[model samples]
Target: MESMEPGTVRPGGRTARVRTAVLQAAGDILAERGYSHLDLADIARRAGVGKTTVYRRWGTVTGLVADLLADMAEQSLPRTETGSLLGDLKANARLVQRTLADSRQGPLFKAVIAAATGEARTAEALRHFYDVRVDEWAPCVQQAIDRGEVPEGTDTHEVIRAVSAPLYYRLLAGGGRIDVAAADRAAEAAATAARAGVFLSEGRPR
Candidate 1:
């Protein structure tokens, strides 16, 4: 019966089971009906857990969403090591495209992003989730620098961010596709820009 806090993790045993069930239920509701429809009592019923437990553990809808986001960050796939900047970036882009195009995850992310606009707690949680993902993939750019593929002052994190930006735009906007071709184009654009010192610090190696 551990009380879960925003940005904190729960341990094993029944606590873990409860967390899993609750988060799954929360995600299902968010994906199907958006953030405004989330309720602790409904989530507890769907999860087959006690309403008292949900209330005591998460306390509020925002808290539960934060925990669900934390779980997603922890469960996200690891970065692939392809031994080349373009190869690594393409891998990253494809991962983003696939996740954003997924039937379940696509709507789930849309709900979260919409929730983030008006909810400070949800926005902070979403920021932390992207921060974790960016940190996970930034090393590939650094490795490129180490191998003389990019400028010494290249902003590695920015390059990583650029690779996924277009994919996300396509997801959020209604006019384009988030397909493999778009992913590859995004990755190539990032890799090319990194090589050309587009992400380098001002007055450094450009």
Candidate 2:
């Protein structure tokens, strides 16, 4: 069979299956050994697919990692609605904290973040991954504005990022514990700031 080109979208059928298996293998290898140890042939073997298939479809390990991040963004859980901005944000924070605190996911994210620090393409892909997640949660912030819980003209995306930033900082720093208290504090800070217009387009509370 002819091999698909790198970066092509294969959403269903046999091609989808191949893409799924290859990405799964790529993720496993990434989680286990980080990006430096990811090899096309090794991933193909682990995924039980032809090396040519993975090579043709992804072109390089960076490409494979980029695709994996894209798929992760696509698979991310939808925002939770709790009828209040703080409640919604707390849910978001806890979700981020849990993912970062998970043994497998923690190391995997650390590996990807470290790789992105040195590789420009990986960095762009990682940015895209965060963009997708932020976009997903931004609507909840907008809802807060609609409810008058937050002031008008606030940056919804920024507010959402605020909710997750401290949790990510703790995860990356390894200097502080990321527990339920930390998550709640992060959410509360963002919510408080949003209500105070700290996330306004002007970037300061009026």
Candidate 3:
């Protein structure tokens, strides 16, 4: 598909193709050059689109990163629904593990995290990335509640966030290895916490 410049809208049928190309090129740049090295002109050239288009569409590197994160959220895996909460959490953990284990995504995330350390907009974009993933998996927690597996007022978002926190810690902090076993541990921890009412309220229903 021919790449369209960032802000340049092509024919209706080609819009998706253009967006895909732009996001792919952005991701490639993020992975290869780090955030500080990213330039709209370079992204346009790599995407085979016009520099003006990239400039008009994204305006800045932070803007491009935000859109890239949004696109990633759109393409992220749907949450699993195994019979048990642990099983479902394990599935979610594995999905996150697989994504982080990917060479391109791994570096792209590192670049984003590095950029976020210094840039407010980049930090917001990074937050958006986690928010999207957390939202995606929250329904699983709700399902667990519906099945009476956990307390009714459990904080689903926190439950979901707990599942990926360690994986990301390993990816960003170099504190540990990220593997299936690690994922299982994360899932188990989250499940255990959920079971122990860590995410639930102490008071009566309000």
Candidate 4:
């Protein structure tokens, strides 16, 4: 179909297999060498799919990368709940730390981030991916509000962002090891700030 992309392959024996293979190859290339070196023919060869299929399906590098991001988001683990706000935040921060510190995922994220800076489509795709992640985790902040642990009017998404902000800062700045200690510290800081009514403004992290 004219509207078909690499991500829209219907579930079946061959179609699912093709999508799985192509996406796997694309992820591997992204994790191993970054997005700058991605090519349809190369991905096709690596995936054992045809170049015509890759070219016709994905259309462009941006489309391919965007679809890859979607796949990553879909494949990501669900949020872990820990009852208390601090507990949830610590879990959240630890997840972020581990992901950013991972050999494959870290480089893959960095590559996508780097690509996003120069490409509007990639940037939008990246933003959407983060939006989905934020929405997924925001229920914890809402639960905190329900429990009266944080102030009313706290930005739920912003609270989640706060937990991830420091880790991303260290990741981009290459400042430290981004270890478990850093994760706990970030969680503590976000929880402290949230409880202090810092992120009360809508959609803004103070």
What lDDT does each candidate get? 0.89, 0.84, 0.80, 0.83
Model 1: runs farther than 4 Å from truth? 1-11, 203-205
The per-candidate count of clashes, in order, stands at 0, 0, 0, 0
Give candidate 3's total backbone clashes. Answer: 0
- Identify the runs in model 4 with alpha carbons over 4 angstroms from their true place: 1-12, 202-206
**Structure candidate 2, residue pairs in collision:** none
Q: In angstroms, how far off is 171's CA in candidate 1?
A: 0.8
Q: Which parts of model 2 have CA positions greater than 4 angstroms off?
A: 1-12, 203-205
Query: Pick by TM-score: which candidate is best?
Result: 1
lDDT of 1 by residue, 65-101 (tens): 9998888888787888999999999999988887888
Model 1 / residue 150 / CA error / Å: 0.8
Off by over 4 Å in 3: 1-12, 202-206
Could you tell which candidate, 2 or 4, scores higher by lDDT? Answer: 2
* lDDT tens digits by residue: candidate 4, 25-99: 887798899898999899999999999999998999899889877776665656879999999999888888888
> Higher TM-score: candidate 1 or 3?
1
